[model samples]
Target: MSESAQQIGEKSQVILHFDLKLNDGSAVDSTRVNNKPAKMVMGDGSLTPNFEKCLLGLSVGDKKAFSINANDAFGMPNPDNIYHVDRTKFASDAELKEGMIMGFAQPDGSEVPGIIRSVAGHSVTVDFNHPLAGQDVIFDVEIIDVK
Candidate 1:
């Protein structure tokens, strides 16, 4: 890296490789899996403000590992995110099972993934909360470039 290499800041375009891991050191995701680094512009809403703060002032070729608390990471699960729907709403051919993730259509035509929490006689409980909610995480990153 050059001494004058750009540092990551507001609106700066950055390219980097990163690994997302749980507090237990279990890997959740990583750019290294396919050897394709991620590219993003700072403050573009692709990252949470706290997550972006971790990248501030980092320069090319810099490597960092940071841990974020549960609330600051994916956030704590919300009770409102859990909903009970009629079993008939599901496809007749669908085999509903605990821990199954299914996509539900939204009013805007987009899809949101919901995890089946429980299946009863006539109702199914689905949790729309993020899978990693309430979990602390570690982010390991290597800055490839910042411009």
Candidate 2:
């Protein structure tokens, strides 16, 4: 589709490529490398308000770069999200290694991924932070489509 002058707004379905990077130019996440452009509905809350606001006045095919603070991007990590789990909860046949991520089921049957921070004796420290939390990031985007 040819580029349109439409301003992104609520209910607009946007298809775009994004690169999330650290201030040091280290990439954190990118849809370009993954070769799968992302699709987001403007008002769905999938993209943080600050992130979405950057696209508000953009038109299709527009490329833009912006920075968002840690709190505005993925809020700071909360200590309460960290948990100490009994080693027994791990599958006996599975490897338990620090920095490894594992899926845990909550009482509500939802699965939450936890990253292992340490394993000592029968306790394993798992952090449930979003990973990019507490760090400022730069976002580069190429708007592919807006409908």
Candidate 3:
């Protein structure tokens, strides 16, 4: 099949430029900014199922913009992901501020990033939810290739 005739499918390899934005029009990420497009194999778990659904049946040169809800996108924030830690757990020299992202070591030795939600007298609130959790997102995509 001709490259231009190939459509995005469950097993197709796709190359595309994409812009991710929030509902309020704030840009989250864009492949176009660096002049480099992204490549991915469909159904490989790289893109969310709902996001991939938007690309199905699209051929090269196709451009589309779609919106995904919070639950379907990054997912809704889980209240259990929030934790309160003693302020002493943080380095004495480290400045803790709301909205600051910091990496915390897990029991398995892998590091997970958490956002500082607040700092009280001797306690700190951190949230481990994905940064975009609970927010609707807009995806703008231009298909460059499908193989």
lDDT at 21 for candidate 3? 100
* Tens digit per residue, CA lDDT, model 2, 1-147: 444436687678999999999999999889988699999999898888899999987888789999999999998999999999898988888788999988889899999888899999999999999878899999999989888
Per-residue lDDT of model 1, residues 1-147, tens digit only: 555558887888999999999988999999999999999999888888988999998998899999999999999999999999999999899999999999999999999999999999999999999998999999899999898
| TM-score attained by model 3 | 0.91
Looking at candidate 2, what is the lDDT of residue 64? 91
State the local distance difference test value for candidate 1.
0.93
When sorted by lDDT, best at the front, the candidate numbers are: 3, 1, 2
Clashes of each: 0, 0, 0
Lowest summed lDDT window (length 10), candidate 1: 1-10
Alpha-carbon error at 126 in model 2, in Å? 0.5
Q: Measure candidate 2: CA RMSD.
A: 2.0
Give per-residue CA lDDT, model 3, range 1-147, as digits (tens).
864459888899999999999999999999999989999999999898999999999999999999999999999999999999999999999999999999999999999999999999999999999999999999999999999
Where model 1 places Cα greater than 4 Å from the true spot, the runs are 1-5
**Candidate maximizing lDDT:** 3
Cα error of candidate 3 at position 6, Å = 1.5
Candidate 3 residue spans exceeding 4 A from truth:
3-5
**Model 2 worst lDDT run, 10 consecutive residues:** 1-10
